[model samples]
Each structure stands twice: as structure tokens, then as C-alpha cells.
Target: MIDSHEELGAELAEKVAAAGDLEALKASGAFDELMEQIDAGRLQIDGKDGFLNLMIKAVLERGLQTELSEHLGYEKGDPAARLLPNSRNGSYPKTVASTVGDVGLAIPRDRAGTFTPQLVPRGSRRTGGLDDMIISLYAGGMTIRDIEHHLESTIGTELSRETISKITDDVLEEVMAWQSRPLDPIYPILYLDAIVVKIRDGHQVKNKAAHIAVGVDLDGVKRVLGIWIQASEGAKFWAGVCAELANRGVKDVLIACCDGLTGFPEAIQATWANTTVQTCVVHLVRASMRFVAYGDRKKVAACLRNIYTAPTIEAALTAREEFAAGEWGQKYPAALKTWENAWERFIPFLAFPPALRKVIYTTNAIESLNYQLRKIIKNRGHFPNDQAAVKLLWLAICNIEDKRARERQKTRTTDKESSGNHLVEGAATAGWIQALGVLSITYPERLEPYLS
Candidate 1:
């Protein structure tokens, strides 16, 4: 609230005296000195009255560039100076308006520059701090008008709804590139699922599917490999998605667990023949429960638990037989029949060791990923189109993937030192047994290379 030149000078001296480093002192000196000089001449100004005015001017002239460049490691100049001529340039322009007592400044541009400074520049009549305010507003699920008023009341920056939209749209291009990036060659386990988002189609809001693929590398930590959008869950769309992963060098997946989507297994097999598609037993039980009567929900749920919680597949089959004999089963015969038909896919976890079984038995891994997606999408009620939906979903996914990647790298380093030899021996032994079994099957020709 210090407004007068003398008051600003006192604050500056106090700040510089308390500063821990030369750079901080320099930054504070520049900001405070500019404010003091600007405030000194303003008529009828008290310490509190003229502070915001002088501070805004100081921010424009030196504070914006200094802070932004320091943060981004960018020198004070054109943001696009280092880019090639043919490369696409990104522009983000903001309107900054501020007043000091009676003095005011508003900066506007012709909407031409390819670089939009996240930090506002000096002498810029446009409102500064709009970028951060806009992002915060967007994250908070505020409508455009609410954001404008919030900024107006909080920082006195006059931001229009159009300007806010323009600023938020800057994230779209970044989202696109991340969605199409290449993935790893081998994912030990892949978790797949879809989140539904509301999108505007021909003036009507409708639901669209956002498919996400997350992979657990050989080190056992999870990373999001890709995100995609589809009109609906179709074999052709999923096949293309699988093909895209293959083209990105995903040669094999040890286990691909997913909800029971038609043709999903075929789509995966087409991309990597050795990949084992394990249906999510949890999802199956939930789907089955939807058909059960309310009066028998508990009993039916108990019967279903026997299928999943049994010690082994053999035990699970025995439990399944008992469940079929129960009164709940007689009432919900179709539910039990459905499980019987799909029992093979439901029981694959029984063949693997407990460590692997823990991961592949349920779709909770992908379901948790979906939970994160929902958290992000809950703020965005409706997108403009399919592309817009994909873009936002990808941005959220990339943010998650980047964080997961760092943790996974650390986990791999630790695992390598602790259990490297054990992992190799186990993998080799499993490969040998699988190879022998394939040699006795009709696909011996396909198994020859691995056997050799």
C-alpha cells in the first residue's frame, strides 16, 4: 500500500537490506525505484492510493521481462529469434490496463505477433497478469465473465471474454503434438480405457469417447503412452490406434488388460501377436451386477466374489459351481451364464505368478487413470468438437506422463541394483517354456524363430 516516492524508497531500502542475493536486490531495486519515481509526481496521492498505479507501470517496463526471462532462461528480446524461418511460431498477446491515482495506461496490439508473453511487457497498454489469472480461472471452472470480474476486482486488469478464450486456446497446439508423440518399443503391461466427454456437435452437446493407453515398462512403473478420440468404440478405430502404436515401435506387450470391448483383443493381436489380452475381471463383475435384482444384490455380489477371490483358477471353478447352485444364481442365471461363457479370459491371472497376477487381474490401474482424467474433465463441461476434446485430454495426460516418467526412471535404477538377475532368469525361463508349448501347437512355424 506504500504509494508516495518517499514511502516506496523506504520499502525498497528495507527489501534490498533483507534480500539474500545480489540478483534479488537488483530486481527489487529496479521495481521499487521505478515505482518511487512514478509516484513522487502524482498529485493527491497517499502511500496506499498510488502503490498499485506505480507498481503496474514498473511491472510493464522492467518487471515483466526480467521475471519472465529469468524464469524461462530467455534473454530479453524476441521469443522467436532462435526459431527457423519455416517453423511454426506461437503468439500469445494479452491486454493490460492499470491506473496509479489519476494516471492510467492501456496497451493493445494489432494481433499480429507470433509470441504471446506469459509475462506482460513495459509500456504495454494491455492488462498484464491476465495469463496467470486466466489459467487460474480456467482451472477453477469459472465462466469467462466470472474470470473477467475476478481479475477486475482482484488486480484491476480489464480482461474480456474473447481475450481469455484466446489465451486458453494457446494450450491446444501443445496438446496436439503430445498426443502424436512416439512411444516405447516394448511395454511389459498396457492398461487401456476410455473416458466420455461432452462435446458440441452441430449445435448440440453430445458424448464423445477419449481413449487412453498407459504402459508399465519392464521396471513395473506406469506411464501414459498415448491418448486418442473416437466417435465410438469400434474395431476399426482401435485397430488404427494399435497400428499407430506399432508404427511408433511398440513391438510387444506382455499383458494388455482392458474392459470387454468387442474386437479389442483382435485389434491388439493384429499389432503384436504375442501380446496377451486379459479382460478386467472387476469390470466384468460390475457389468454383471447391473442385471441383478436389488433384493439379491448382496448374495449375487458374494457369489461373484468367489470367482475372483479364489486361491486359483481350479478353486475358482469349484467356487463358481457352488455359486451356480445358490438361490441368487437361480434368480440371476443370465449373469452366471455370462461369466461361464467368458471364464477363460477371466481366469488368465491364475496362470501367472502372484507379482504379475496382482497387476493383471483388474482394470483398476486404468480405472485410476480414468479417475485422473475425470478430475480434469469435470472442470470443462463441453468442448467444441472431437479435436478439442482430444487436445484437452492429451494435455492432462502429458502432464501426468512427464511426472510418471521421472519417478519410473528412479524406480528402474533401484530395481536394477536389487533384482536385475532374478528378472532376467525368470523372463528367460518363461520364454523357454512358452516356446516349447508353441512348438507343439499348429503355429510351430511362427514359434521356430523364438525357439532358435
Candidate 2:
């Protein structure tokens, strides 16, 4: 086996080489010397012996001092120094203990002293009681009682429910700040939708709508723009939400895909006049399928698929008319009517390039976001209020944001193609603009500015 001095010298050499500049070299040398002293058993505490204990004590003391200085802005000679007063009159006491393996240095402390030691004791390397338990419990994802039992059994410490609640409650303010954060000015594509949750309003539990806005930005990375918990999902509420986004610097959105909620299209138009609203084709198909009999579901779905998958609007329309003339059409006129009513809005997607078509044709992107949200909220049967639901959903969205960031990074590393350029080409085409015009009449207020 290599001698201890050789190992220490190798470590010192590696650290010295890694040092960047003059100041870093000095710091590295100091740390290396400290390590050397401990390894040689040259440091002693109260007549106790070993190099390992002294190293641990030194590390703990330095860590506590750094935390206090950075977090509390405490400087040397400051009055706040008394809070974690030095053990040996501003010097650290070295107490040696047999239980501490390796380097032996025991730290001495005054029992009656006002200094509440934040570090591994003034001399001991054992961790503090409450703080360590709190960190462990949080890392384990244990509920309050489980955390309490864990601490009480493992460490023989009494942890109360109220204290645990207070600790977890700190996340509430963070959630609020995150929910209201500013968003980028232009998102090439946006997905908007709402998920319902049961929440207690006063004494009774009621359903509340949690509206979400997710977008693909200029860099092609998905981001959550904002989340709001409202009493209900309505045009008026969405109008206010749109206004809030505008105020927070969302200047433009090229296209917004959403479920067919009444007034949502109008709400989006009120904020961004040029924005195109793509009704969720999947939601439309599902709603239409609900009206068909079990035996007829497959046939009905086939006919609907024909309309959407057709190569052109003219071809889709011809197929729709032919299907309406068929026997199944006579039996399920309402399903056909649903498609007819939405046909004008639906066909505009065909005029765009395949890439743009894939994104605007459905609300599937937002649906995936909703699926993740449901997984998170599923365990909680109900919440205290709308704000509580909002907080949970916001936390869930933050989790998703991290996942999407990783996905975008990978996508950027692999794909270098641009999206949305063809969308402008389709926008300026006379035939495509005319096709959009037919649906505009049904949505006059929303389409007027774009038509002009």
C-alpha cells in the first residue's frame, strides 16, 4: 500500500494544477496544507489523538462559517458572529474521540455559552438535530407523519406535524412567484387548455378550472407561459388571462391550438389580433363520436378520418358530401352536421405545409401536458381552494418544464431544420386566406382584424 504522505502529496499536486489564477493558487495551497497537517496527525485537540477527526472538525467549521457569511451576510468582527461564536476564542477547538475514525481532533465547547453551534458541534462532527432530519425527510418524499416517525425512530427526535406543515408551506410563496413570471414576447405556436380539479370552497367541495398556456418559442423549446386557477373557464376569464399575458410582454402568437371551448377563440383574438386559433380536431372527433351508437362508432370514425386526412380541402369536402349521401350518413346526420359546422375551420389546416399541419391540426401537445398534470393531482382527492389547486398544478408544471428543457436540448443537438416559414407562405396565399374567410363569418369578432 502507498504511504499516507505520498497520497497527500499527489492530492496536493492535482489541486495545485487545477488552480486557475494567483488567488486560487493561494486558497488551494492553504487547503492542501490543512489536509497535510491532518494527515500527519500534527494537529491535536485537548490531548486526544488522530488526523481524521481534526479534518472533519475543520471542514465542518469552515462550512458553517461560509453558510453564515453568505446567507446572513455576517462579516468578521460583526455582532452576528456571536450567533455561532468560535469555540477557542475565535479559534476552533480540537477534541479527539475514538469513535471518530482516522484523524482524531475533539472540539471543546462551553455548555453555558450563548453560541448556538451551527456546524458539526464546536468540536464534534455529528450533524445538527432538526435541520438534518428536515433535509432527509424532504429528500425521501415522506408525508408529515412518516417523516415524524422516521426521525423519532431513527434519531430519537420529536418532530411535530405543525412544524412539518410550516416547512412544506414555504413552497407556496415560491409557487405563486413562478406562476406570475414574465414570458417571452413571441411564441410561434401555443397550446391552451384547462383541467378541472375538486377544491373546497368554504365548507363544500367544488370543481375549479386550472387554465394553462404552453408555447413553443423562437428557439423551438417548449415553455409554460402561465397558469391560472379561475372559478370557471369562460371567455371573460380567458380575456383577463390574455390581457395579463400581454401586460407581461407576450407581444404575439402565430397560432394557438385549443379545445372547442366557447369564447376561448374570442379571448385570444382580443389580445393578439393576428393570432390564428386552431380548434382541436381530436376533441371535435371525440365529441362527434359520443353521439354515434356503439355499433356505428368504427364506421363513423372512418368517415371522419377521411375528411381530415384528405390531401386537399376540395377532396375532403367531396368526401364529406359523398359520406353524407350514404346510408350511414342518413342514420347519423348529427355527426356529419358537427363536422360540417367545423369543416370551414378544419380545412384551413390543409393549406399549410405538412410540418405546420401536424402541429395545428390538433391539441395533442397540450393534451400530453394535461396527462402529466392529472398524474400529479390524481392522488389528492380535493384541495382547500382554487389557489391550492393552482399551487399544485404550478408545481407540476415546473416539473414538466425541466423535462421539456432536457428534451429541447436533445432536439437542438440532433435537428437543425427551421419550422414556421411555410406558415407565412400559406398565410399570404389568396386561396388559403379565402378558405379561412368562410369560417371567419361564424367567428366575426375574432376574424375581423385578420380579414382586414
Candidate 3:
């Protein structure tokens, strides 16, 4: 006779359920038994001692049987079953993806071909949120080997590093799908940056650049446009990136805030004729401070601030000219020249009001994102290849974007017209609403088509 763990578990579950409190259950040894079942559940992949895997499998199978009963129009042993047109038919074996690992299932069937499941569902490979959970853990800096051990200890299923890699590799498809998704026709602002990580290129570990593009929608919300991996950071690759953005529906970009990236402005102009390319003010200040003596850095930074914060572009230019003629500027000639060369790009944001200018004056928004990605990259140390690096970055991107989406869902948005202006409500009111007001006033002809 075969031993009945299921019957024993059911009896235990019933007694545990009837117990008055924790001490009562502990006195009956039910708690210890449950722990034993969990420890016993360990297996190479889908271990039997794993109470969670067993429970999940049981629920899904029971759900299938219940669905089968409904489809056949009779209970398992009802007299009506004998009279039914399409009675019970045996189940065929199937496997579904799960966090505990792949769950082997025997999905009950019917004589009729009409049984479509709702729990696991027909043609569905995974249930709910398991894949996201794996990606989240990986993004939070868990290596494949670490994640494998984590799943084994927490969920009682051991998966090979190859299996974990395959799971994360799936993110590449998602990243591609997201990259090709259509963009909003007009992005008021866009910030672009890159982070370099070491990846093995066949025989040698080489630096790989992960370029990230973030767009600020009209509502002032930040959206990560895409992540691209390349051998090096150069302007040449940007042309392709800009072209891809154009193809994906970015017809116009009002302002692009970036560091002193060569050839980037030309690449952007190639796509959107009227787009204004603005150098990151914060980056320029940092570069300036590097050249200043320690004693004068604060003063140099203050002078640079006065230039960017000046109410008018002409005033900002006047302040910059004064700074170039000052003692600190004379001492750090290269720093002044740096700003002078990029002044054409730096002055655009000055034309905006303080509320609007702050949003476009720097690439800090995207830099903040890079800070998060860099943390993940630092933990990984080095990846096996470009694909591995990209896969990890994409997973991190997914987790970050998911958190943003959840936050957006919790916030309310409003589009109210007041005195011939539109306000992007929700958190947008803080500055996005004001920035929209400025864009509408500043780019009337450009904003006209999109006004609803």
C-alpha cells in the first residue's frame, strides 16, 4: 500500500485550523510537523518535501478538476454524470512556470474540447507575478548563483545557474519590445547618459557602455525610453539611437539636457529640426570645480550659479563674461573656456522661467537613474558578456519602472484649463504644471496641434 502524505497533511491542517492559539498548536506538535514537511520538501528542482510546491500543485489541479466538472455538466460521481453527453476524460501531464520552480500538473480534461482553465489558463506558461519576482531579486543585486540558493532556501526548489540565466535572459525580449514601443510625439525634455561596466568579450573583459534615455512627458512625469549597450561611448552611436527614437514616434523634442557629449546635438537635430540642445548646467559646475583651487571652489561655484540663475539670457551672458574676466576664471582658464564653448547650448534654459528652467537646465533626473543602475553594476563586478550586462540592466530598469508605475497609479492627474492655459494636475502641479504653462506660451505653434 502506498503511504498517504496528502491524507496526513489534511488531518494535520484540520487540527491546526481548529487549534485555539500558537501554544495549542505547538503543544500538539503541528507546528513542528509543518516545519519538517518544509525541510523535507527540498529537491533538485521540484522537491516533494516542499509544502509550498505541493500546495500550489494541489490548488491548480483541484482548480482544473473543478473546471472540468463544470464543463462536463456533472459532479465526479453524480448519477447525472452517466447521462451526460460529454463525461469525464483523463488529464494529460503539463508543466507551468512558478517561483518554487516549474510545477508539474495533471490538468483534468473533458470528452468535449471546451474546457478552458481560468486558474492557470490555457496556453499560459506562468501564473501571476513569479517572473517579476525573479527579475526584481536579480535587479536588487542577486547574482544567478545567489538567486539559485535564495530560491532553494526560501521556496524549497533548486535551479541551476543555467536555468536562472535563461529566466533573466527573457528580459532581453521585454527590453526589445519596450524599445520598439511608440513614444509620445512631443517630449518637453529629454536627458541622456551612459554608465560603463566590464563585460567579457570572448577572451578578454572589456568596458561596455549602457546608454540610457529618459524623456519627460508633457505631464512632467519621467519615462525611461530605452537602454542600449555598445563597446564605447561616442557620438557615432547616438545617431542610431536618435534615429530609433524618431522611428518609435518622437517627432519633436523641445529641450535635450545632456553633458558635453560630442556630436549629440547634431544627432538630435537630424531627427527634430526645432529641438534645442542644452548642456547640463550641473555637469559644467562640477567640471569647473575640478579646476578651481580648494579655497576658491565655493566662490567659483557661486559665480557659475549666478550665471545660470540670471533672469534673462543676456543677463546670464553678462554674468558669465564677468566670471571669465575674474581672478578664479583667469587661474582656471580651461574651465572658463569649457563654459564659453558650450554657452550656445547652455543659454537656452536661461530663457525659461525658474520653474521651467530648473527642469531642463541639467540632466540630474537621468543621472539620478544612473546612480541606481551603477549600484547594481557595482554589485555584479563584471558580467560574462554584453548580453549578460544588458539583461541585468534591463531587469533593474524593469524594477525601477514598475515602482514608478505603482506610484503614478496612486497619484491623481488633472488637465484643467484656466485663463487659456493647461495644468498637468497630480504631482505635476509642483512644477510640471508650471512648465507646461511655459511651453504652451513659448511654443504656441508647436503646442497647438497637441492641445485638446
Candidate 4:
């Protein structure tokens, strides 16, 4: 036993030394040779300590050497290397912590100290995989402190909160890129909603609204187009948001469903003159119930439902009048006024066929997204600034979308006929086909051009 252990230690030391010997590694073609052996069943990678570590070492060293070659404008043995003022200055050992384990890398250096390798950047203690893990945890609503504890408990890595925060901060650039990405020329439906969050502005923490716009494409797939932050929303603010969407290539929105957003209809009309602004029936009901007594909520909701569920615009108006004159409406006049306030937007919902009504009657699509988002941000009591808030929200959105994609992929494997547009928990807009048919007929000129 003692002799076998000694031999193992010696083999390990040799492999460690071999990792730093870049010249010998290159001349031997060790990576390709090892791969060939593995392919031929002469050697194996069993996720063990020595060989896997050696494999990681060889790959990192080779990559660094290639980067150095590119930087110097010559290969290792090329006669053209001598013409350049800079050359390889050997390598230093670096142990990068990856998901598999800690990998000892032979980071190459240049004579002029100008070869900054990007594969595993200089001074980086861990690989990009570790950073990605941290970002994923952060996106899943783990606070920096929680992530620190999680890494320590799981991987035995004691990363500082600041370090974890910096890792997550790298997502800001991606957020900016995603925010400015172009959209489709037209959307069959758009769901607009706002989620209020606390953000510190200067010295004082104040409430702010993060407005999200979700556009449903011709294929019935919903994607969050963009997120805009504002201290408060107004006609000018909403108009700016609409203009940004328009500039991002949204030529028109056939039907935009939203909660009672002040001046949102005007903003939509300003951007797309023919865009139909539909108030969310669920939101209107909830708004009316805001002033109603808790005990009267059920009765009030049923009464208000009659207004929104009426057969036609004329019937809806009559139902609204009946509700206002009814005892419950007179008892809760504010609830009645809520319906009166959104009557123009509400009538559009009445005009749509039942199949299309189910899609446009509410902003449930965006609301479900916001529900997940709230869970992510709930741990964050308040963001330091708007940018910080946007960054975290964007990461959370990415995490949500990724989970949905995985679900769709899984569903595709099992049920080949399933459309990939399903959201979380296999929930999607039912009757999208019928809804789309209605939309095409209603706006034939605008909708048909894109269908082709």
C-alpha cells in the first residue's frame, strides 16, 4: 500500500511539472495524443483527480500558448518569430476553480508583458464557469451574502460578497445590449405593465416603477421587448417608452392590453395611430374592488363582471349604468367611477370575439413574468440606483426565459406536436390560432403583410 501511494504521488508531481513545460507539451502534441488515446479506449477520463486535472492543465496551457503566438504574430517554432520584438516568456501556474474542481493552469507570458490572455485572464483566480454560477445564483434571487454562504457550503470557496457582486455586475453590459436589441416590425398583441420597486436615489430611498413591455409575435411567442425606469409615469414618459419601442422596429401594435396606465392610450396612439388600446378586464375589476369593503368584494366583483362580460359595446355601457345605479355601486361610488374611467378602453375588449378576447382581455402574460420578477427582487430591499435595479431585473428575466426554453425543449422531446411557445408550468395563451385569425381579418392590410 505504501509503495503504491508513493508511486501515485510521484506521478502526480510529474503531471504538475509537465503542465508548466509548454515547449515539451507543444512538441509532444499531448492534448491531441491524449484525445486519441481516449478515443481508442487505451485511456479513460473518469472524473478522477490526476488525469482530469492534467487534461484541464493541458488545454489551458495550449490555449494560452496559442494566444501568445497570435499576440507575437508568429508560431512557436516558426522562423518568423525572431522578427518580432516580443516572444514567449514561459508560463506561471494558476489554479482556477471550476464546477468540476480546481484546475491548475499554465498561463503563458510574453517578453513585452503585453500578452493578456482572455481564455483565463491574468489575476483571475477562477474560470468563467464560477462567475457564471455566481450570476445564476444571483439571478435566482440569491442575495450576495446568501451566494457567499452557498458557495462556501457547496464548493468550499469563501468568496467575498463584494466579489460575488462584481461577478453579477458583469451582467450590466448584457442588459444594455438586450435592452437596445431590435424588435419585430409588428406585434399582434402587446401587454404593458409596471412593477413598483424601491430604489435609492442619492441619499433617500424612493419608490420607482419599472415599466415592462411584452410583445406577442406572429407565432404567439411572447418576449419582453424592453424595460424602462421612471420616477413616475405620465403622458411624456409613456410616449418616450412608445417611441423607443417604435425606434427599435415595432411598426405597429394591433392590440395593446394594459392595466390602468395613466396616459398610456395616448402614448400608443401617438406612436401607432391605429393601435387599439385595450384595458385589462382583470385589472379593471381589481381596481374597482380597491375601494370596496373586503366583505363586499365577491358581490362587487360579480356585479362588475357583468359590465365587462356584456355581449356588445352598447350592452356593456348599459350594464355599466345598471351597476352604477345598483345598491353596491351607490354604496361604493369609487368602484363605479373606476369602470367609468376605463370605459373607452373597456369597450374595445367587448368588441373582440371571445377567442381573441381571452388573449387581449388582460395583461396576464406580463403579470406572470412580473410575479417571478418580484420573487427575485423581494430579497433585495432596495437597489442603490436605477442601473443596479435594471441589471438585476434583466438577469432575473434571463433566468426566467432560460427555464422556459428548457421546458419547451423537454416538451418537444416528449410531445413532438407541442408548440415551443409555452411559458412556465406549461401555461400558454389558448386559442392563439383562433385569436390570430380574428386579428388577420380585423386588420387585414396591417396583419397580412407580416404573415407572409
Instruction: Write down the TM-score of every candidate.
Output: 0.68, 0.64, 0.79, 0.79
Residues 1-452 of candidate 1 have per-residue lDDT tens digits of 76655466444534544554577866667555645555676322333234455444444534444444444444545566455232223323444453322223222221233334444544344453445446545644465667777766765556578877777677676555555656667666788888888989897988878887777654345666677777676766878888888888787676788887778888888888887788898888877888798787887888788778788889999988988898877778888887887787788777665546677778787777678778877867788788766655654555454455445455444334322111111111123333234323533444344335
For model 4, give the 10-residue run with minimal summed lDDT. Answer: 418-427
Error of 2 at 162 (Å): 2.5
**Tens digits of lDDT, candidate 4, 83-189:** 87888888787787765457666688888888888988767888777888888888888888898887777655667788888888877776787789888899889
Clashing pairs in 4: none
Show model 4 residue runs off by greater than 4 Å. 1-91, 107-119, 413-428
- Kindly provide the TM-score of model 4 when superposed on the true structure, using C-alpha atoms: 0.79
Question: Looking at candidate 2, what is the lDDT of residue 441?
Answer: 46
Alpha-carbon error at 61 in model 2, in Å?
4.0
lDDT of 2 by residue, 1-452 (tens): 53564354444434444564558978757565745655676443221222333334455545555544554446545876567534223434443222233232233333334444555554343244344345334433344667667656653445477766665565677666656767777766778888888889888888888888777654445566777887788888888988998898888777788877777788899999988888888988997887799998988888778888888888888888988998778888988888887765567677665546776788777777788778767767788777666656665565565455455456446343422111110011113333344444435664455435
Root-mean-square deviation of every model: 10.6, 10.8, 7.3, 6.9
Cα-based lDDT for every prediction: 0.62, 0.63, 0.76, 0.79
What TM-score does candidate 3 get on C-alpha atoms? 0.79
Q: Can you write out model 3's per-residue Cα lDDT over 387-419, one digit (the tens) per residue? A: 778777766766665565546556744343321
Q: Which candidate number would show the highest lDDT if scored against the true structure?
A: 4
Candidate 1: what lDDT? 0.62
